[model samples]
Target: DQQVKQNSPSLSVQEGRISILNCDYTNSMFDYFLWYKKYPAEGPTFLISISSIKDKNEDGRFTVFLNKSAKHLSLHIVPSQPGDSAVYFCAASAPHTGNQFYFGTGTSLTVIP
Candidate 1:
């Protein structure tokens, strides 16, 4: 069974709007959660992250919200830009898993001008 899943395959938004992407995980041991953005061929770049101890983390236009009780998380991009268009992935790592990360199926976000 997949530990992480992204229910939405894609989302589209106009520029300068908010883009929301959701993710869910089955593992409760996951202590660290992160969001990564990827281009067509390039590797995914880290976006935002939150620890199990924290409910939220934000960076610039990106924000990540974590709900430990629900085993769910979401990424919100404010003022989404065309350049923000990309595949967004949710990842989690457990303390016992070392550096191993479990990734969710990505959600493709399209930002229209």
Candidate 2:
């Protein structure tokens, strides 16, 4: 199910301008979406990647967009989630003390792979 969707089918941005990508999701569980991927892959990559710019425009000048604008690429999105209700905890203890440990509160986690 494509719970999360994009606003536009296709968009074109200028060389030096802001590109605001709008993403909408039908499910309320998704609180945020990761925008602007970090780095480019070796080859045949899928996703928009923009690096930090000197001007600090925050759009990062759309590095991947500028480089690969000539070629058409497909973007694949697959959201992952936990199957059952499980609590994940992280505990810490001294080097030699096995019994003396501290545990964090149980938190339900959904993994997006």
Off by over 4 Å in 2: 36-113
Candidate 2 global TM-score: 0.32
lDDT of each: 0.95, 0.29
Instruction: Compose the digit string of candidate 2's lDDT tens values, residues 30-94.
Output: 22222322222322212342221211112223222111222111222222122211222222233
Output the lDDT of residue 35, model 1: 95
Q: lDDT tens digits, residues 1-107, model 1?
A: 79999999999999999999999999999999999999998999988889999999999999999999999999999999999999999999998889899999999
Cα deviation at 61, candidate 2, in Å, is 6.1
Clashes per model (N, Cα, C within 3 A): 0, 0
TM-scores for all predictions: 0.97, 0.32
